[model samples]
Target: MAFTFQINNELQFNHDEELLKKAEECCPEIKKETKKALHLVKLIQDQTQLDGIGTSILEKDIDQLSDYHLKRDDSLILDFGNHYVGSFSVDLDQVGSPMDAPLYIRLKFAEMPCELNAESQDYDGWLSRSWIQEEFIHIDELPYTLKLPRRYSFRYVEIKVIDTSPKWQVVIKNPTLITETSADYSRLEPLSLEDKTLQKIYDVGLKTLADCMQDVFEDGPKRDRRLWLGDLRLQALANYSTFDQCELVKRCLYLFAGMTAENNKISANVFVKPKPLPDDTFLYEYSLFFISTLYDYNKAHPDLAFVKELYPIAKKQMDVTLKMFTEEGKFIPDEDYPVFVDWSNAFNKDTAGHAETIYVLKQFISLSHLVEDEDEHIYTKALNQLSNYAKEHLFNKEKHLFVTGENEYNIASQVWMVLAHVMDDETNKKIMNNTIEQLFPIKNIATPYMYHHIVEALFEAHLDKEAIALMKKYWGKMIELGADTFWEAFDPDRVSYSPYGSPIVNSYCHAWSCTPVYLIKKYILNSK
Candidate 1:
């Protein structure tokens, strides 16, 4: 399914207060750091940047921020010189005359320069406009320190004087951002990668993960500031590789375990504010990922007691998902519980879903071994049945690729199948080779999540050179495009592509895009 807004308000959820208390207990005390504006800037046209917009440094120094008071329709951009997620505060006063009327000011926080150039009114996307990081405020008194209540993810802050009485101008001073995250920098292990580009990618990925680390691992701190199961799976992997924050992973697992649908299926995402409520939307792969996440966690930390406590919840998710399988071991997709193989619905996901089932089942079986569950044989049987079905029906030996609904050959199918390892290693390598020849420059796949899978599949298939080339090409392009952190949606063929229809609402530092840290650590550095 496409990455768009999904609302299912009618679905019922049970919130276990006791488990929620555990979630709260595991919540990390967010670390904060104060940052000051680095320079005064103005938007200029540059075709290289997003939206054909760039910034030019103004002649004024940041020290003179309060010298030039802003009148009606006056504005200036403050460059923080880096990306940050935090609350913004600035001191304001009146100049040239006594305070006459309330100083009407508008502030726009942007992670990039293009957002400042795009007017919010011009946005007509289906995503909520409330996510636009612009605020209109009126200060009735002089010498007011305006601190925004809502948290924002941005690098550039645009200050516009919507209206300040004709007699006086508003003086701005000490514009600061109090950045927040749950990451402890000191705990991070240093890396010494010889490849400069790979090192850059790894560092950016770590920052993206660290920024998304909050009360819960948020999918994107910009708009959908909530815990998504798919994002949680990837974030947990990156966390284990870098910060090694096991408690945060435990907290997230308990949060999802504490609340689930009446049918025992975990929600695709959860909300921590106003109360811990599970979203009505459910994705088959995301629910199954709970099993993989727990598996990865225990493999990393090996806590049998924790796994035993949460094993039943993970097993319930597997049972609920397994019921969707047909008698022939094919995954029958349900409209209520869709499988998210990728953002594009252009390709039928049955084959990919089938492969994901196998992937998670393998992990779940490992978890069963940890808990010493007696029913491990049941999962093994299902896994074999699914693998046999894939090889007999889905695999096209002649084409060296797997086929999905309507006998279509797509990259997602091959990548997922290779990841599932339904075929032998040499055959998997040949399938990926064919996939590279057919789908080298991937098109219409806009998510880094899917790209991560593609790269991982390449690594799994022993196509190390091809994997590194794709990584440098796809992620290096983001670096060339001036990304401080990776974006939520990026298509190398289409520089300005947005799944949300407007780049204004796209998250620049998304959680899923941070998998390079995990990939490099697990496959590259650790392999050595």
Candidate 2:
């Protein structure tokens, strides 16, 4: 499922006060820091940069920001030197004559220069234009500080003079952004890597994770500012590797556990604003990821008491998902509860869905052992059945890759099969090598989320060189394209592709794309 638009408002939910209280107790205190614009910049056409848009320095010091009086149709771009998620404020005053007409200005917050170059009026994407991060304001007084009330995620702030009186111009100064996040950078231990590129990748990943860590692990601080199950799974893994903030993970777990559907199924994501409420959207693999997340957390932190508290809820998720399988152990994907192996639905997901069942079932069984559940054998039997079915029906002997519905062989099926360990290590390596030979220079798939799985599967298969190569090729390309932080979607073949049809709405710093830290630490640095 692409996750474009989904609404299931008819579903009933249970808000358990006990779990909600635990969630509140674990809520993190957001850290705040003030950052000033580093330089004045203007957008210029450059085919090398993202969307063929690059920035040029204005050669003016940030201290002299107030000297440049802006009249009608004038504009200035403030470069913060790096990406950040926060609120912005600036001091403004009149320059010449008395304030006659109201100063109508438009402020645009952009994560990249291309976003500043793109016009919101030209945006015809299906996503809500309200998420454009551009605000229009009219100031009637002079020497007043215009502090925006909403939080934004960006690295560039473009102030455009929509209209100003011919008698007077506007003077702007002391533009400040209050950066916000719940991540404690002081706790980050310095890691020295001989490989500079890997170090850079790790650092970027850490920043991406830190920015997304607010009261909860948001998918993106910009758009979809909420906790998603699939994104949470990857974010928690990266959190364990880098920040290791177990309390935030615990808080997120309780939020999910507190508000499941009436049928005990977990929602795809949850909203934290008005209150802790689960979204109506649901994904089969995402719901199963709840089990995988709990398993990974218990492994990282070893909280037996906490595991016991959430084990039953996790088990219920497993039970409901397991019901989607047939007696032959083949997963029948429900359109109502889709399997989100990747955003592209062009490929069949049956093989990926079956492999995902095997993946989460293995983790669930490990949790069952922690709680010493009596029904462990039932899960074990299901795992065996699913694995056996995959090995027998999905694996193509000649192609040396997994096949999905109607013998459709794609990268996702192969990647998920390797990750699930549907076959032995030697065979898994062969499958991955075959996938590279057949599916090299991947096409149509544009998400870092899917790319993360492919890279991790390479590591799991002991194809370290291949794994590092793919990471550098995919993530390094983002850095080359001038990304201070990673993006939600990027297709090397097509740099301008957006699931939302326009880059204006795409999340530049998504949580799922922050897995390089986890990968480098676990695979390259070999850190615990």
Candidate 3:
């Protein structure tokens, strides 16, 4: 996820020790399982695979890994059979004469085969190179278990003997990955779907969520492993339907509530390692999501006291968001805290931002009632003012679609407006039908985050057929392109497009993309 990286050093933040202590109280124990390398594989050029790269399993038996003695330049790739978040270790022994030189080896970890094909040196994107999962090691002694100290999210590991003197070759064996996650898959009841494709999509989406369910819901286990308020909202939704790990969600809520700017603004994301520090980066919608998350949590789990405790933080968020609107309810977005509808800047988000305000404002009002806030009546008026402004100025009745800056009609504006219930049911259906006729084949836009909103809008408009088809067409395409899990960015128009100019930094298993679990359970199962 290549977000706008901004650091505001002058921003003063508050750290509520009580909230932090509660977060610590809710911390989950890391669940783990050991997995062995299933096969030895060869990376090959294949058009069928994603990024024009695929893996071919070698006939060599994994049990006899030590048979293939590795000398200078000899290399092998170990297939872990599935993607996992954890550490890897392999036993190494000297198979030749006395070891004349220290064994220098290079290990490259890949979530997918294409990542292995992409040369790390060629990646000069905005993301830090240190996040790249590749390491070079020099082993001075023999008969050592090469246990990588750092955790990795991957399905494949390529090991190369940079130099093992002709005197003795290095023998490798017992390659194992200790997988880690806080999600309990055993809790899920077996789901039987008539459509096999939807079943696969659901399973993949579940795995995507499971892998990212660490101590806190990480946006991506491979990169940006932190609790993002926006991502947490979706992850918590999916978790409620599947893992039902409400405590993790509660902990994440406190983590954000514990650290906020003095203006009552929550950070876009927070790092939990060493100490919980909110990111300096901020986004318009992400901060508002704190209220949405708290609201959703109350809906799913329903604890009046829990809601009461977090209500003030959620209200503070709503307060900050309310300031962006004019007395007439016009939303003038600030550049410093831009509304991130998606990673793409190709489309204007003026109308969508306004609609999101309505979406979260409604959520906040519901929360306000539960907490008995005296200021609750104020938001009820603001909601009407916002909805009125949208219907009067933003919605183009003639075109039957919402308009953004420069009269640019886009999918995001319609999706968010539909979600916010800016109009009556009939009007929503009409707007969505118009959207389908004009924007059937989604292009330029990617990010499952945005795709989720579009699919949800279709469902909200009662266009079940269109909604399922879009889900199949967009997310199914990811499965077709070899997705073990969903991606952070994907554009069917440009299948290989990466926001950071390289697929290496693209997050394959992302939090926002894993909502199929919630969608399937909420829409499909409930319909039946």
- Each prediction's RMSD to truth: 1.3, 1.2, 1.1
For all candidates, what are the clash counts? 0, 0, 0
Q: Candidate 1 lDDT (Cα, whole model)?
A: 0.89
User: Candidate 1's residue-wise lDDT over 162-259, tens digit each?
Assistant: 89788888889999999999998889989978999999999888889999999899999888999999999999999989898899998998899999
How does model 2 fare in lDDT? 0.91
TM-score of each: 0.98, 0.98, 0.98
Give the alpha carbon lDDT tens digit for every residue of 410-505 in model 2.
Answer: 999999989998899999999999988999878868889999999999999999999999999999889888888899999999898888878889
Cα lDDT listed for each candidate: 0.89, 0.91, 0.90
Candidate 2, clashing residue pairs?
A: none
Q: Per-residue lDDT tens digits of candidate 3, residues 1-528?
A: 425789799999999999999999999989999999999999889887788898888887788788898889999999988889999999999886998899999999988899888888999988898888899999999899999999999999999999988788989989999999999877888887999989999999999999999999999999889888889999999999998989999999999989999989999999999999988889989999998999999999899998898888888888888888899999988888888999888888889999999999999899888888899999999999999999999888899999989979999999999999999999999999999899777876889999999998998999988889989998999998889999999998788888887877788889999998888898888987
What C-alpha lDDT, on a 0 to 100 scale, does residue 502 get in candidate 2? 85
Q: Whose TM-score is higher: candidate 1's or candidate 2's?
A: 2
